[model samples]
Target chain A: MCFRDAAVRLRAQTIWSGVSLEVAPGEFVAVVGPNGAGKSTLIKAILGVHALSHGEASVLGLPPGQAGRRIGYLPQRRSFDASLRVRGVDIVRLGLDGNRWGTPLPVADRFRGSRRRDRERVAEVLELVGATSYATRPIGQTSGGEQQRLLIAQALVHDPELLLLDEPLDSLDLPNQAAIAAVISGICRDRGITVLIVAHDVNPILSYLDRVVYLARGRALSGPPSEVITSETLSQLYGTPIEVLHTSDGGLVVVGHPEAPAHHSDRHTGRTHERP
Target chain B: MIPSAGATGLSWNVADDVRQLFAQHFMVNALAAGTIVAILAGSVGWFMVLRRQSFAGHTLAVISFPGAAGATLLGVSATAGYFAASIAGALVIAAVPGTGRGRGYTNQSAVIGTAQAFALACGVLFVSLYGGFLDSLNGYLFGTFLGVSDRQVLTLLAVAVVVLATLALVGRMLLFATVDTDVAATRGVPTRLLSIVFLVLLGCAAAEVSQITGALLVFALLVMPAATAQQLTARPAVSLGLSVVLALVIVWLGLGVAYFSVYPVGFYVTTFGFAGYVLAASGRALITWAGTRRRATPAVTR
Candidate 1:
């Protein structure tokens, strides 16, 4: 995945601009930011769900949304409808053929070997995510962590080369957060799939991450955690006297930064912002 | 056979009465048309219920009233008017710009509510101007099974087939999108196109069902059966199939009751559908309560 001097604007206001980044295959990069940061926009841009105002971006040699099934995306945490009756495994099956347009005629596919193959693949993915026990359970009835695992399984079932997850750890407990991050990191290692994860907190994925793209005040600084999570780097990015305090457990906390505006422009309009 | 009913000269013979209900040509047409409408509404309405778009579905159904009335005033077939108006209504609702998923619901409901209000007013105005067809207007609003002709049955069949076939083609994607739209879109499911197409199909279903249940009572068939089925199962295929079966049962019973009585079929259909929904809801609640109590008892014993 690559973005060269990319910019995005919504309603004539620039949300972010002049952004450039690249991720090689098999790398796990976390796009972390403050509330108004353009992390989601960056994901949207790569997915082609949002148009870039300027610059260039390509995912798997195609522009954004054009990458089609080659890119697997687990969007920001959202609940399935309570009445949605699909099981965890069925959701994985959807990743295999959800985009295909054809009559869901059962008789035609009964004798097809590919159908059996798809089911095996789905079962394999469920086991990979440690969700085999709940594979037949309704998704809505599962816990948040379980549901997140199922969603990750869905994204990974097709074996995409690029996996983009938006805030997969949000609302999860610390243990669950660690477990999910570990599961994703394991998949990335085993499958050689590149990953870009949008996260509000950087601690859960700090160990597995190859790089961190920190966004604040419409600017981004990308490098290893030791290089980017320092007090000086984030303070400079946010234009504030932000302090990165190191916890006893070897975690980092960003403090003294201004509260983000309630309405995040990029989230609403799929635009990007740039530092003035 | 006491002389208590001699003044009315009416008797109840279940088998003969049922035979008589389907013996007439018009009655057969009504039965066929109602069956088709029930199936279409059940299939499409299940998705609408799952997507939480029942309000939008109701608005589209109500929009058919003015369409039918306007068609009468223009000396055109009410069916054509029903399709045009409901489809137009669906597009108008779909055109609302969704700022984001969280904020989109409020905007969509506001837009749909405004459209529904305007449609009701237009229906009233058209009815007053087309006074010559007041009886037909009443039929469209309250429903009449006796007036269904063979041609109408054929039209319903064609519309049902098209709607069902299109739904079959898009059902999987639609379910994925409806449940997890953000993820589905990023995976290249064409979520926007699916939304529009589903709404159009919903419009077709509403218009077709309104012929038998009337504009106001369309929800009786569209929402109730689906809601009931969902309450009973957490499996998509089972719920969808159950929705269709429940709808068919209610429609058949409603038509039979209306044939032997003086009331309109819509009344019986809506009542039966509502009853099914109530039963399903209470049964689900009872099972949940029992499960909770059972679990709690084990903990207390331990």
Candidate 2:
């Protein structure tokens, strides 16, 4: 699939500009950016919910709208209507096929057996995400972390070939975040599903990502982590000297102090060290 | 009043009115029309609660008053003017984007306010033109349940059945669209189509209910039942069933009460609906509180 020369503009803000990218089958890409960056916009544009003002985009060799069955999505945590006592099974079943509510389909295609299959698939996905114990529970009754796992299960229930996640762990605590990220990585890898996940930091997903794209201020840097996450690229993206340090704790940090103007000291220097 | 007839103290004749209710020409027509309006209101009210468009419901009712007022000033059936104005109001609001639009009810409020104001102005002008002791117009505005004609009732029933059936078939997609629109679109659910369908259904319901309850009074019967259902149950089917049941209870009760009082059924129904919502909400809270207390008690045991 191709996202060719894509640009997005809000009334008073520009999110993405002149960005081009390609996604292949079974690839897991991480999109990392700060707030107000174009990460989520990229996901939505690819889904065709938000049209690109300029250039063209396609999904799975088809336009986004036409690629419906192939793309599964997980949105960030938002409380659903409390009255919808939708069991985890029901939500996951939606991925397999939507809920029929008041409308019964015509005869010869009522999908009678589909109910059983949907339940089985729901169980399988719940098991995959360690949520089998609560698959029968109502979504509204679950905690935030629990709801997030269910959401992931819902996204994968149909066994879609491509998965798009919009900051899936933004609301979860640290332990849940690690748990969800691990589940995502294992499932995508085992199933050979292509994934594009957005998060504020790429470090949690750094090991599993085949490529990382950093979007900031309407511009972007994309490539393998080694190529695009360098200090020089990040500094330019943030409009400040950002230090990518191999800290004593064996972790990488991208830091820039806005108040400390003209002061540049990095334990690990790269490309060009700005003068103090 | 329907009476229980067995020593078992459990069974009762169901008024035998389901048949007789439709036997008399006026009853038959009023019921036919009522069924159509009920189904339309039921489905539209379902999504109206989902979209938090109760305000839209109220606004449409208010604005349609002017349409009725003007039509009646010339001694015409106000239904024609109401149907036209209601449809127009729904379409205009539907045309506006759903989010981040403006102050007061977003696009829903903005459309209602503008449409209603224009309607009120038109109504005054029409009244001025005719000037024939404009009490009939006022009565239509408030809705007279006794005024329900045979023809109007039949039309209401017809429309309701269609709306309810349509919702039944596309329900899965509609749910997907309402709960997680982004996900729904990605899965190719035709979210836009669902939206348009919802708007049209709502338009039809508003139009029919505008006849018996009057435009301004439809919400009492439309919104109350669904809202009450929301706090009472989480199951979609159950919620819908409860909504319809509650609306019927309130409307009929309001009608009965109106028979004993000077006020119209609309006033009584709205009051009853508001009280019903409060009661259901309180019940929900009580259950939640009890559950929490029960959980905390185990900590003390430990």
Candidate 3:
């Protein structure tokens, strides 16, 4: 996947501009930044849902959306009402044939083999994500981590070449976040599928990511995690004095100007001052 | 002329009353039209409730009031007005500039509410302009299954075939878009276009249901059965089929009961539907309570 001087504007406000980045096959990359850095917008632009105001982007050797059939996407987290009665397995199966024009027929057809193949694929992905135990349960009744796993299984059911996930770990606990990150990293390595994940905090996925694209102040800097996660780089990116502190366990904490606290925090609750 | 239940009243024999009910030609026509309306509304309403667009569905049903009234005023068939006004209202709602999320959703609801209110007012205006007796207006507003003609039954059947066929063609993609729109959009599903198509189909459903349950009580067919079925099961196909079955039961029983009484069919339909929904909801709650208690018992024993 590649972007050449890509820029996006919404309602006359330039979200981010002149952002050039590229990812190699099988690479696991994280797009991390403060809130309102347009990480989600970047994902949308790559998916061709949000048209770039300038420059261009290509995914899987084709223009964005043209290669949609081979690109799997998990949008930002959405809370399912407890009354929602859709089973987790059905959600996974939808990834396999949800885009098809017609409902599946119960009667045997010439394509019976393909129907069997589709069911097998859904089961395979569900097992892969460790959601087989609760696949038959209503998705809304599951815990947050369980739902996230089901969603990941849904994204992987079709075996796409490229996967774009927006905030897959937003509300998960630290352990679940680390586990999900490891699962995604394993998929990236074993299946050789390129991944672009948008995240609020970088610590959970820091160990597994091959590259990091840090966006802030209407700009982006992409490089190896080690090169771009330093205090100097982030401070420069935020256009403010920011400090990146490495913990004893190798996790990093970013703290900004005392009055304008940095937006990157592990616990993203009750802090509502971030810009959109 | 077919005999009215007023002559024989309802007998103690179950089979005999049913036989008497089906013996009337008008009753047969009502049942035929009701069956088609039930199936179409059941299937479509499943998605409508799933999408949480009951408000939009209600608005379309409300639009039918003005549509029927306007048609009556213009010396056209009230059915034509029901279709025309509801479809046009659907287009207007779909054209409203909003992504159906957050702020856009707020804007959409406001517009929909405005449209519904305006529609009701227009219905009253049309009725007054025509200087028609309140009896005809009551029929359109409260529905009349008594005088259903063969052509109306055929028309309802034709519309059901087309609507259900279109729904089948787009069912999978529509569910995908409704459940997880952003991902579906990235997957190249035309989420916006599908939403519009579903709304139009919903409009058609509202219009047809208005012909049976009346504009004010369309929810009797459009929401209750689907809601009850959903509460009973988590599987889409099973729940959808159950919705249809529940609708059929409600319509058949409601028509039967109404035939024996002085009340309109809409009253019995709404009553039976509400009863079913209450049963389903309470049953779900009871099961959840029992499960929690059972789980608690194990913890205490340990």
Taking all chains together, the TM-score of candidate 2 against the true structure is 0.80
Query: What residue runs in model 1 are displaced by over 4 Å at the alpha carbon?
Result: A16-18, A53-55, A83-86, A103-111, A235-243, A255-276, B1-18, B99-103, B132-134
Cα lDDT of model 2 by residue, B8-92, tens digit:
3212244543443334454334444544555566557876786667766666666666666666665777777676667776776
For residues A1-276, could you state the per-residue lDDT of candidate 2 as single tens digits?
688888887676667888888878888898876665667778888777678888888899887657776778886445554445556666776767773444423232335676565667778898999988876666667776777788888889888888989877665667777888899999889999998998865666777789888887788878898777778888887788887876574456676734232222121132121111
The Cα local distance difference test for each model comes to 0.82, 0.69, 0.86
Candidate ranking under TM-score, highest first, comes to 3, 1, 2
- When summed lDDT is taken over every stretch of 10 residues in candidate 2 chain A, the lowest stretch is A267-276
**CA RMSD of all predictions:** 5.2, 7.6, 3.4
Q: Higher TM-score: candidate 1 or 2?
A: 1
> What does DockQ give for each predicted structure?
0.48, 0.39, 0.70
Q: lDDT by residue for model 1 over B1-302, one digit each (tens)?
A: 01111222224877766677666677778789989999999999999998888988899989999998899889999889999999999888778777124223456788778889999889989988988556766787878666887888998899999999999988888887777777777766778888889889999999998878889889988999999998887667778888999999999988776766666678889999999999999998999899889989988998
lDDT of 2 at B69: 69
Q: Which ten residues in a row have the lowest lDDT in candidate 2 chain B?
A: B1-10
Model 1, span A1-276: residue lDDT tens:
888998988778787887888888899999988776778888888888789989998888887778787888898766655446667776777888777776333444567888778778888999999999987877767787888899999998998999999888876778999999999999988889998999888889888999999887777788899999998988888887888899998888878768643333234233211111
